[model samples]
Target: MTKEWMNWYRETLLIDAHNDVVSKMKDGGLDFCQRQSATHSDLPRLLEAGVNLQVLALFAPPDSNKSVTLQRILSYAEYALDCVDRDPRLHLVLTKRDLEALSPAEGKLGVILGVEGGDCVGEELWILRLLYRLGVRLLTITWSNRNALADGIWEKDTRGGLTSFGKEVIKEMEALGMIIDVSHLAPAGFWDIAEVAAGPFIASHSNAAAVCPHPRNLSDEQIRCVADRGGVVGVNFYGPHLTEFGSASIDDIIRHIEHLWNVAGEDHVGLGTDYDGMDIVPRELEDVTCLPRLVEKLRQRGHSESRLEKFMGGNFLRVFKTVLPD
Candidate 1:
């Protein structure tokens, strides 16, 4: 890396809104603190990439029974906390103040715990509260399947939106100051959230469907809704979401980023990466350590320093500042 590039990266408050390293760890993968060749991210590489904050997702397969899912989530949450507790370089971010204090230059990696699916929540409001108390500051309502809360992208043909319980969950989440993620939610459910959510929400790890036409990617209208609410759409690094052709590359990622920027405006775009959660990634962005290359490419594509900052982490920081607890 160039000296100038290193300086720019260190000075920027880089944040990745979604990563599934915890799930990988749950499945006998390497710990986040260790460097690994088997997964997309780890602490060593994240530090090398100057990632100031990383939101680690607690996800279970959608087909698991509710009780089993809940158990798995709890275990993941515990493991996440343990990982942070054991590492001096990592800090658990639980409030807006914690987020505001993050600085990549200070060599600290802020960690935000998030639940990636609501099936584990079942029909309970208290469980949601418990998750908040346990320091989970974000929740993705569904995971490409129907749940007590709502239908996911795979169930779009059913025209299902938020169930009554799902509406209540949204309200409670807002009351608790937790970020509601709409990534895998079906179109009906996505609109339902736009109608019920009184604050900005995030499509944490989704791309623009208008660019790639994947079911998991958001449509132009969905992107506009998120931007209109002063929310942000995180560009997923998963290849299928980036291209209709064979394998993707960093340029494919840029294509989706440009599309999201045009549709959602500059301030609404950010990176989600979804590392360790996907089977394949763009060749240039194979791991977290390659983040600087992506930034360099964006810079080469004529993105100004200020716009680069927003796309890197500033925009997401603004939303977190607004949505997170005091």
Candidate 2:
């Protein structure tokens, strides 16, 4: 890596828009404070990668009982809160001011809770309010399955948009200053969100289907729409999303970033590694500690220091300032 790239990375506040480490932490009875080979992230690995902020997803798997699933999510939130309380190095950021006060120089890592599926809310707006009270700042409308709020990517046959309840939920979330994430919402639902969102939204962990033809990936038009709405599209690093082939490398990731940049503009693109959520990752970027390797490659591609800074995290920071509650 060039000295310029190294210095820029060191000075900038790098953030990953999405990570599923908390799920693994809870499922395996693992501790976030200790390094484990079982997951793609740990506290030490985050520090090593210079990650100033991370959004930990609170995901609930599909099951028969919605109440039980929500209870499990609550347990996860408690675990995350307990972790933050015990670790001086970790800070849970609930508002814009908290994020602004984060000090990487002091070795503090800013953590934000994001609910990956609105199904966890269980058709109750009050439950959504409860999650906000519990410190969840980002909410994905759906997660590859139909929910009371809307359809996910896999529910294409329905071609349904947000339900009546979904519209109310969006308005309420916006009023509460909670960010609406569109990563797994269906194509019709994506447009529905665009029509209703008064402020920016994000695709926390998605890639360009134009680059890799996965149904899970966003189309070029979707990427452009995200940028047009003054939001950010975090380039996903999962192998299947990065390429048609099962295996992907850092170069494939770079290709997605390049395509996103070309379509979404530099200010609207960011990184959302989706670590621990995927079974396969790019060989070079096997874990959080290898983030710098991608930076080095971007430098080799001649991305200016300013552009690189935005891609690293500035874009999301800007959105946070705009959308986070004062």
Candidate 3:
């Protein structure tokens, strides 16, 4: 990498909207504070990659009962807190002020807690409130299955959208300053959210369906809707989402970014590499430290410094600033 891009990358406020390291910690006893050769990211690797902010997801298997799911989420939250407490360089981000306090030069990794599915919320708004009080600032309404809130991408046969409860939950989330993630929501549910949401929302870790034709990827219209709402579509680095053949490399990642740039505009593009959440990742992007290579490739593709900055992290920071509480 050239010195110019490297310097620019270091100075930029890099943010990833989604990661599953917390769940990995909960289930596999993965150490977040130490460098782990088995996982995609850890404290040392994230610092080396220059990631200023990382949103760790609290996810439970969709099939688990409400009680089990709630317990699992709480356990993950506790573990994440423990990890933060164990590492002086890691801080939990709760408000806009906390986010603004992050500086790449300080080598502090600010963590924003989020939930990958709303099943833990069950039919109660208080559970959601509890999560907020616990420092969860983002929630994805569904995973890949139907829940009390709405149907997921795999529920297309049902043609289900948001339940009345789902609409209420979203309104409550916005009022509580929690970001709404629409990554695994079905098309019907995605449109329902667009209709009900009064503020910007994000597809936290999804790619472009127009490029890879995967259910987990968003369509051009979906991308446009997110951009129109002043929201962002985080490019997912998972292989299947990036290529039809289920194998991908850095070039495939660039293809998705290019498509998102054209369809969603520069302001709506960001990185949400679902690291530690997937089994397979794109070649050359096997871990967090490879992020600079991705940016270098974009630079080679003629992306100007300002545009590359947006794609790298600026877009998500703008949305977080807008959506997160003061």
Candidate 4:
């Protein structure tokens, strides 16, 4: 048998469900193909970090305090796709096969193009179809503020439910086989989606509200809600999300994982470390390469190797496999 050390650092594929690498890459004055990384993640760093799948968000913060036009919206997605298409190393993915095709040597990283907010398309459903056709696999209904699609966690959800247009958007995404992401949706919007989204969905980069009082997390009921629908909640590793005082360490991250796993069951819990998206991370999980530390920690916490494997990668992969279109 191989030494325990040999299998200890298992080549488990790490997938951070949300990363702002594309935009930050742009900020570093590097385009997709040209991104050499002066910042958090680059192609080389991702490989060094032992990542299998990296979700690159097409985030274009509105130029105005409120970006109220379709023309200005989706520019980031359009450009990000162009960047991906230009780089043979990056493959835009909308289906499971696209993910299966990734090769590190080829610099071919699996990129699931996701829009952070549906504000770009306004109330029109056609834009979703266009975005899907453009290779977007996931859509977060809202970001920090309310929009035509849904209310964001930052905003007070006066409506207390999904709007009529939001329901229609969900249907379109369902028909198109796109995954509905609820990271920033308000409580009302969250439940509204649970009722309408036909297929299972995910909170791509959210934590348990019980762990952190942040508006961005799923409440205990919300956690159960997503799990009941066969969806996974990728427990976030952001320091703020994992700690109640917002004072945290990697241990806090583990607590949330253990908590979510215990509450949501093994199959429905996974990691969605919102790298680059959050300013603060647990001290132990400082960089991508430090992920193995988390595995060892989980082992100490009485999580069997099998459970660790599932929590680390298997769960997210399962969700992705289930949600990807035929």
Candidate 2's C-alpha runs over 4 A off are: 2-4
- lDDT for each residue of candidate 3 in 76-160, tens digit (9 for 90 to 100): 9999999898889999998899878888757889999999999999999999999999999999999999999999999978899
Candidate 1 regions exceeding 4 Å error are none
Candidate that beats the other on lDDT, 2 or 4, i.e. the better one: 2
lDDT (Cα, tens digit) per residue for candidate 4, span 1-326: 24573354435555668777676765556755543635556666666666667777777664343344354345666667777667666666778777666543343467788888888867678778888888888888888777888888777547555789999999988888888888888888888899898778899889887877777777889898888998888776677777767667878888788778878998888877777677776787766667667777778768787887677667777777788787
Any runs in candidate 4 off by more than 4 Å, and if so which? 1-10, 31-38, 62-73, 100-108, 157-159
- Cα lDDT tens digits for candidate 2, 3-30: 7756667778888999999988997999
Residue-level lDDT tens digits of model 1 in 117-166: 99999999999999999999999999999999999989999999999999
Cα error, candidate 2, residue 44 (Å): 0.8
- Return the TM-score for each candidate structure: 0.98, 0.98, 0.98, 0.89
CA displacement after TM-score superposition, residue 172 of candidate 2 (Å): 0.6
Predicted structure 2, TM vs. truth: 0.98
Query: What are the clash counts of all predictions, listed in order?
Result: 0, 0, 0, 0
Q: Local distance difference test, per candidate?
A: 0.92, 0.90, 0.92, 0.74
Q: Model 1 misses residue 216 by how many Å?
A: 0.7
lDDT score of residue 255 within candidate 2 = 92
Clashing pairs in 1: none
Alpha-carbon deviation at 209 in model 3, angstroms: 0.8
